[model samples]
Target: MLTNRQLQILQVIVDDFVTSAQPVGSRQISKKDWITFSPATIRNEMADLEELGFLEKTHTSSGRVPSEKGYRFYVDHLLQPQIIQADEANQIQSVFKQQMIEMEQLIRESANILSELTTYTTILLGPDVQQHKVKKFQIVPLTEQSAVAIIVTDNGHVENRLLTLPNGFSPSDIEKMVNILNDRLTGVPLQELHLKLEVEALEILKQHVKTADTVIQSLLNVSTGQKEGKIYYGGKTNMLNQPEFHDLNKIRMLMDLMDKESQLQSLFKPKDKGIQIRIGSENNHMAMENCSVITAPFSVGEEQYGAIAIIGPTRMDYKRVVTLLDMMRNGLSRALTKP
Candidate 1:
């Protein structure tokens, strides 16, 4: 538990360091308009804060820098809601107001806008199509041995897979399979379609189709193998401008991590329904130890569709970024789900 004075001093130190990227000295803190403490008294509190591991005294200077512990505490306790400027609020509103048709384009543009607004790297994960229910299913025949199976989701996304027909498969087999799938699987979420088929649709298909085994196997593959959400990035190179990334080895590692889709996906933990902040070391990646990640999940209707993440130095402007994400997520959800 920190005294009121300690909390006040900590907030000022964090705010100042975030702006200037410099270690803060007691004398520098005493000069703030709101601080009434003399330099000596403030320095005593600084030393105590350092002893408590909330602050670190750099070897090169007597001034103090907030430790990861300090940052975590500050974020959890001291942050107040920051109102964005009217022009900036208008800019965000304009994104949703645009007559955009495709959700992907809207998400991509949002990523760019956020990165520009925060001057940090932005990552937007597109809606997970697996959560979408089946609106329709279509089978189009091509050659005697091959055909295409199309799955249309309730949200109007279409996924097509080419399948090799089993020997002796006939048009009646195709028609029966399509009818059985449409009858049984319509309105089933894609992620649940596989289990629903194995448990429910298989028995129905067996009763109707001659080549039930092969046909059911192909459908199973389709449900289980659909791609996960696509990732969109904005200001991929923006981290290069942060002073902490000047180390060549750090920059190389960070750039490499960004190139990997699998690793990048790991940054957004599951069930992150609200704004979550992970500071340095909490991020659990070597490349991100000097970084901070702020994530907010966006949704389509009631289901969690995807997430947005902003990556910046640990000395991030938390108040501003959090405000932007809070507004942006609501706007995105509304636009995507609007009738």
Candidate 2:
């Protein structure tokens, strides 16, 4: 319900604070060539904005800063979609062109490029393995009692784990087990393989009882317990350079959250293809209350796959971040699809 003048004043305050990282005063607003209002009138509008929870005054100063709510409103209402310049697009395209051979390399390079471009920590979630069908599985004997199980997914991703065999199990027996397992369940998704193994285990115990029980348990444990979707992070130290993270405790909390990739991934669970912006305090994590997250989901096909996000202080350059992220997502999708 803010008047047009009030909204204009609020936009100026937000834009100035985002650029300079300083609180905006009515005097500064009045001095702007674009603002036609007098200092008294602008100050009254700012006061009304503060009362409406869109602005906050720091200390005893007359200067005002946009609250998290104000930022949310501005992004949802006042902001327009920004266009990426040709030079920026060229730089990103060059990076993609250089690393188009491998998916992991492409994602890693994208994360690095994004962090460098934005000067903020960037996280790229690798593609989900559960949705990928198993291309191949092999059991290689390492020692008399140990074997390495390697599973390759349809998307060219590989996972390996060592399995300890029963004391008397021979290498030949392990090979036999591998052949049997692969023959029965090679092309299925790893998640489905786990379920199929559970059902087969009961039948195998009732029928083949002694021979398949031990092998079934070993294969089930290795395949089903495999972890997937690693998180790649870059420019973690960049957070410390922001004014909001000058506090040691704040930096520590952010560092800890970054270190916990599982938690960070959970924080940005996929929610469709569009960009999502989480302002300060909207995030459930208490440590991230002063920060903002800008994320966009990407996919290999019809199914939504993974996401990339930029983390910065709440006063971050939203227009630029949104523009860059949207472009990055499209670039990443194109890079991933390239042969």
Candidate 3:
């Protein structure tokens, strides 16, 4: 619904604000070499854009800043696909070059690199472990009172938990409990392991093991822990450097949100398989009203696995972040799915 000239002016305002964190005046837009309009004509366009809700005039300055709607429109309509520079592409490639690296290490390294490149907070949600079925279960006794409960998933990820053996719980009871877990839980997805254990395995354990309740509780703790993808963070404190985050109250809310797993999980949940951008209030959380989040889902082959997200002020460098995220998403998918 916008004229070409109006769109051109809006893009300029967004680009300038993103770089300088200041309201952009018509004089500034007119100074661009590509802009053919005079300052008066550009100011008319700016006024029109503001009336259309794409720009907001600040109380302290005559210059204009892009509203949240402006940023959305710019990203959806005016943003151009940016080609990753060779050196930056090489930097991303370096994350995958190591041989025999653990999955956690790869994801952790990717998060760090993305944060370093963007200079923003980066979050990587690891592959969903619930989709992986149980591959093996073992309980190794450490002493008469304690043992290590190990759960190995089909993806080769291992989880270990220390369980305190119940008083008078015998070696025979331990052996029986391990047998029941392997029999009823092998090949079961981690998400369903807890319910399956309670419904089908608990009765079997009770018939054979004297301390079935205690044993089931310990196993449930381990299975429940693996129900969600692990979260990895890089540059968690980078947001403190952004000018918008200088407010103490805002910083406190954001920091609290980061420490909470459920909140962080919700932030990364993807609406679709492609890149998703939530600017300001679109996030529906007050703590994020001044922030923008960009998410890119990564997959292994055709199965969507997990996602990566970057959080920054609403004046984010959308073109650069989007391009880098897509490149990294493709690279992560290839690295994960490679045979």
Question: Which one is best on TM-score?
Answer: 3
lDDT tens digits by residue: candidate 2, 1-339? 889998899899999999998889999999889889899999888999999999999996779999988999999999876787798778778767773155666778888888988899899897776666676778787787677887776665666776776677765665666665566666787768777777853364435334555555666764455365768887979999999899999999888888887798788755777999999888889889999999898775455377898999999889988888888889887765543
Give the backbone clash total of model 1.
Answer: 0
Residue lDDT tens for model 3, 1-339:
999999899999999999999999988888899999899999999999999999999999999999999999998998887888899999999988989665678889999999999999999988777776787899998898889998887655677888889888888888888888899889998888889988999998888886778767877876666556789999999999999999999989998998987788877778789999999999999899999999988985456488999999999999999999999988888887775
Whose lDDT is higher: candidate 1's or candidate 3's?
A: 3
RMSD for each of the candidates: 4.9, 4.8, 4.1
TM-scores of all candidate predictions against the true structure: 0.77, 0.78, 0.81
The true-versus-predicted C-alpha distance at residue 3 of model 2, in Å, is: 1.4
Best by lDDT: 3
Query: In candidate 3, which residue ranges exceed 4 Å CA deviation?
Result: 135-152, 161-186, 191-221, 300-304
For all candidates in order, the CA lDDT equals 0.87, 0.79, 0.88
TM-score of model 1 (CA atoms): 0.77
119-237: candidate 1 lDDT, tens digit per residue: 99999877777888887888898988888898887765667788778888899899988888899899998989889989999998888876677756777876665366878999999
Supply candidate 3's per-residue lDDT for 280: 98
> For candidate 3, what is the lDDT?
0.88
lDDT of 1 at 199: 97
lDDT for 335 (candidate 3): 86
